[model samples]
Target: MLFRVITLFDEKKNKIPATIVHGATIEIIWTSIPALILLIVAIPSFALLYSMDEVIDPIITLKVIGSQWYWSYEYSDNLEFSDEPLIFDSYMVQEDDLAIGQFRLLEVDNRVVVPTNSHIRVLITASDVLHSWAIPSLGIKLDACPGRLNQTSMFIKREGVFYGQCSEICGVNHGFMPIVVEAVSLEDYLTWLKNKINFDFNI
Candidate 1:
C-alpha cells in the first residue's frame, strides 16, 4: 500500500504538465485520495478500540502497581486463579543474568503471565511517581499515574513471552523496570495457576 502511494505520487509528478493542469487540481486529487485511504484505516481502528470492552470469558484479573524501580503484580480474583493476591516484583536483569537471546536492560526477573486467547483486563496505578504499562504486540499501554487507576483490556492471540519497559521516568531505577508478559495456552495457564495456589511452585 505504501509503495503504491509513493509510486502514484512519483508518476503524478512526472506526468503532470505545467501547461495542462492547475496546482489546485493536484491538491484536490491528493487530498481526496489520502482522505479515502485514511477512512479505510480509521474505521477498523475505531472498531477495535470500541470492541475492547467486550469479552467472552475472563479467567483471571490482575492488578499492577508501579513503584520507583520495580513492578508488582497481584491476582485480584480467584474464580479460576491460583494465588493469594500474590505480589511478584519484577526487576531488570543485570549483565550477570544476561543469557543468549535475552535483552540487555530489557529482561526482568519476574514476568506478568496471562493465558492466550483469554480476555484479560489490567488495572494499573502507581505507588509513588508516575509510570506506564506498555506491551506492543498485545496493543496495551496506559499511564500508571499516582492515586489514579487506569485500565486496559487485552486478548493474547499467541503464546510466547513479549517484553516492554517503563515508559515514564520515575526515579533512579526508572530505566531498570522492565515488563514481560508470558502468554500460554489456557490449559497450561490454568494448570500453572492451580499449582501456584496449591503452593506447588512460585509462578
Candidate 2:
C-alpha cells in the first residue's frame, strides 16, 4: 500500500504527472486514510486503557514488598498476626532442590495463593531497591518503587500456577527473584486460609 501510494511512477508510467502531485483529492485520500485508520484503532485502545484503570471493589487485597532478591507478601484482608505470622517471604528454589518437574528458577518457597473468579488487588512496593513484579501469563508488570506504591488487579479465571520474576536490574542477585501465584477454587482457598491463618471468618 505504501509503495503504491508513494511511488507515483510505476512500470506503466515513467514520469509523475504534475496535476496528480498537486491535486487536493490525492492529498485528501492519503491524509484521511491514515487518520481514519488511527481513529478506528483508538476506540478499542482507549476502552482497554480505561478498563485497566477501573477500580472495582475487591474481595481481597494483597501487599507485595520487593527486596534485594526476594519478595514479601502480606494478606491485607487479615491482621490476625499477633504472634503467629500472616506475612511471609518468597525465595527462589535452588537448582539442586528443584523437584523433577519443577522449573529451575521459576519456583518459589511460598506461592501467592488466591481464589479463582474473584477480584484481587495487589499493592506492590520495594524496600531496598527498585524492582518489578511481573507475571507474563496474567499480563501484569507493575514497578515496585521504594517508598511508593503501585497498584494492579487480576482475576484468575481458572485454577493454575502463574510464574514471574523481577524484570528490573536491582542488584547482583536480581536473577534469583522469582514469583509464583497459585489460583484455587473458593472453597479450597477458604480452607487453605483457615489452615494457614487459623482465623475463623464469618462468611
TM values, all candidates: 0.68, 0.73
Question: Per-residue lDDT for 125 in model 1?
Answer: 97
Window of ten residues with lowest summed lDDT in model 2? 76-85
Query: Whose TM-score is greatest here?
Result: 2
lDDT (0-100) at residue 194 of candidate 1?
67
- Candidate 2: the clashing residue pairs are none
Considering only N, C-alpha and C atoms within 3 Å, which residue pairs clash in candidate 1?
Answer: none
Off by over 4 Å in 2: 1-51, 80-85, 200-203
RMSD of 1: 8.3
Q: TM-score of predicted model 2?
A: 0.73
lDDT of 1 by residue, 59-108 (tens): 66789999988999988666434435666788888989798989998888
lDDT (10s digit) by residue, model 2, range 1-203: 88876676564676655454377888999999999999999999999998887659998889999999999998867655334547889999999899899999999988999999999999999998999999999999999999998889999999999999999999999999999999999888877787777777654
